[model samples]
Target: MTTKLDGNCLALDTVSLSRRNKLILDRISCQLYPGEVLGILGANGAGKSTLLNVLSGELPADAGRVLLDGVVIHDMSVGELARRRTVLPQQAGLAFNLAVREVVAMGAYPFPELSARDVASAIKAALQCAEVAHLAERRYPELSGGEQQRVQFARVLVQALIARNPGEARYLLLDEPTASLDPRHQHGLLGAAAMLAKQEQLGVAVVLHDVNLAATYCNRIVLLAAGQLVAQGIPAEVLQSGYLRQTYQLDSQVIAHPQHPERPLVLFA
Candidate 1:
C-alpha cells in the first residue's frame, strides 16, 4: 500500500503547548507513516485532545514545530492546510439548521468548490460510507446523538476526500470518534478507518477511550499521562495491566481477541 504523503510529510518535532500557564504537552515528538493508524491513548485530561489539535493545526504549538512531511505546518496558510489535512473535533458545530446533505456539502466548500452535481455525488458517497445516506434529507439537529455523529463523520469524510490524490498525502484526525456511537456502528467506523489506512493507505490519528478498539484498529498506540509519553508501540508491548493502572488509574486486564488477533479485550480488573 502507498504510504507517501504530499509535499514534505507530517511530523511533530519536540512540540510543546500551554494554556493559561498550564502545560498541556511537554516536548512531544512523533512521526506518522502513510497507511498507518496511530492511536493517541490517554485519560480524560492527559492531553490527548490537545495533541490532536496541535497536529490538526487548529491550535498552534507553543514551543515547537509541526512539519507536514518536511514542510513546517505553521508556514502553511489555513487554506493550504485545508488542502492537506482534515480533523474531526470532538463536536463539530452547527449554527445554521441544515440537512445532512447540506452539512456534508460543507466539506467540499474548501476545495475545487464542488458544483451542484459534484455536491450531490460527493454527499451520497460520504453518507454511504458513513451509513447515513438514508438520512440524507434529515435535519442535523433532529437526529439521534449517534446519527448526528455519523452525519458529522460524513461531513469530515467529504472534506478529506473531495479532491484526494494518490500523489498527495492526506491526514485524518479524529477526537474520540466513537464517543456517541453504539457498539455496532462504533465497530463499523473504526473498522472502516483501519481498512482505509492499511488497505487504502491513508494516514490516520484518532483519540480513543476504548483500549480494545484502539488495539484492534491502530497500527501503533501512543500513551500520555499528565503531558508525558508513558507508553508507545505495538498493542501487546504497551497494553500491560500495570501500564493501564498507572496511566489511567483504572484496574483493567488485556487478553487476545478470538476474531482479531492484534486487538484484545480490556477486561475489568
Candidate 2:
C-alpha cells in the first residue's frame, strides 16, 4: 500500500505541536530538499531539537502534516522510514563494551541479506568518511567524547548509505552533531555532510548552535525563536544582524566571511 514518490522533498505544512497546554511549535513550516544541507539554528530552548523530532516523525504534530516526497510520514512503516532516512541524535550512549567496528556495523542491520563482504565494505567506507578508521579495533567506551561522536556519525552514515534506494533520495537528521567535537572535527563533520548532500544528493537537516558553521556549510538556514520560525532562507538573508539580535537577544556582529564573501560570519559583540 506504500508508494514511492518522485523527486526529493521533505515538507512540513503549517505544523503545530503543544505539550501539557504549552506550545512547543507554532504553525511551523519548512522544506528540505535533496542536494542541499539545511541548518536549523536557534538559541537554547528555541525548539531546534523539538523541530527535528517532528521532522523525523518521532513526534507528531498536533496540526498540519509532514510529507516525505509527498507521502504522509506517519503512513510509512517504521522499517520503511528507516530505509529512507537516518537520525543521529545529540548523545549516543553505550553501556556495554563494544568494539568501534561493531558499533559501525550495527548500521547495516536493515540490510540483513547483504553479503559479509558488502557489510564490511560499507563499514569501512563509513569509518573512513567519518575519519575514525584508525579506531576500528578499539573499544568504543574507551574512546574520547569526540571520538565517540565520530563513531556515531559513521554509524549513521552507513545506515543512510545502505538504506538508500536506487535513484531515490535519502535524508539525514542530526541533532547538535558537533557538540562534543573539536573545532577541526566540527568543520570536518559538517564538511562531510555537505559533500554527501552535493555528491550523493542526500537531504541533510542539522541542528547547530554555531552560526559561522551553519553559514559556511548549509545552503539554507532556518532560524527559530520561542518555538516559532522567525527566518528561513539563504544564510545571507536569514543571518542578518538585526534578526539574530532580536532572536538570540545577544549583541553580535554579522560580517562577510573573508574568504567566502557571500557567506556571513557571526561574532559576539
Candidate 3:
C-alpha cells in the first residue's frame, strides 16, 4: 500500500496549471516516495510532461502546492532544491560541442562543496550507471539520439549522487527519458533508474509512454488523461482494463506477466 503523506516525500497536493489560457494540468495529486520509481503514463498531449515539470518546480502550479519533505517547493532556494533533486527534461539542448565527460561534469555545479576528486568520482560512477562510459571521449553533438539521451541521463545521475547533504532524501525527475532509446537501452535505462532507487534510496519519478515498461519497473503508476489524473496506485491495481481504455481510448486484456507474474501485461486489441 502507498504510504501516507508525511514529511518524507515530494508530492503534489491538488496541483493545477494553465498554459495560454488552456488548462494543461488539472487537480493532480501524487507522491514520489524515497526508494521507489513513480511512473507517469498517458496518451500524447495528456499532460504527462507538464505534471513532471510541476513536480520538478520548473512550472508553477495555478492552484495548489508542491511539497518536498513537507515544505513548499516554491519556498526553497534554487541551490537548495538542486541539492535534493535533479530533473532530466524530455530534451536537453546543448549548443556546445563539449566531450561527454564535460557534459556530465555540469551536474557538479549545483554542489560547490564537491572537491575535484569528488566530482571526478561522481562523474565516473554516473557514466557507468547510465551505461555511457565508452562515450566519455565522444563529442556530445556527434553522438546519435539514443547515445545523447543516455549521456543526459548520466549528467542527471551525477547531480543525484554528489549532493551537499548525503543524509537527505534525493530525487530524480525524468520526462520521457527512454523515448529516443532502443528496446535494449530503454530497459537498461529504466533498470538503472530502479536500481538507483533501491540502492541509494532515491525517489524517481519518470514519464513513460510504454505501459509494459511502467508495469515492469515502477513501484507505482499514475495515469493522466487530458490534464486530469485518471488513476494512481500500484501497477496491479491501476493498470486495469477500464483505466487503460479510459486513458488511452483502447481495448486491452490485462494479464500477469509470464516471467514476472506480479506485473500486469497489457495486450491491446
TM-scores, all models, native as reference: 0.92, 0.96, 0.96
Clashing pairs in 3: none
> Which is the better candidate, 1 or 3, if ranked by lDDT?
3
Residue 155 local lDDT, model 2: 97
Best by lDDT: 3
1-269 in candidate 3: lDDT tens per residue? 64456667999998989999999898888899989999999999999988988899888999999999889999999988998999999878778889999999999999887689999999999999899999999999999989999999999999997853555799999999998999999999999999999888899999998999999999999999999989998999999999999899999999999998988999899
- lDDT of candidate 2 over 1-269, digit per residue (tens): 32234346888888999889988899998988988999999989888999999999999999988999899999998888887888999889997999999999999987787889989998999999999999999999999999999999999999888746567888899999999999999999999999988888899999999999999999999999988988999999999888898779998888888998988999988
- Which lDDT values do the candidates have, in the order given? 0.82, 0.91, 0.92
In candidate 2, residue 22 scores what lDDT? 88
Backbone collision count in every prediction? 7, 0, 0
Using TM-score as the yardstick, the better of models 2 and 3 is 3
lDDT-better candidate, 1 vs 2: 2
* Candidate 2 ranges beyond 4 A from true positions: 1-7
- Cα error of candidate 1 at position 179, Å: 0.9
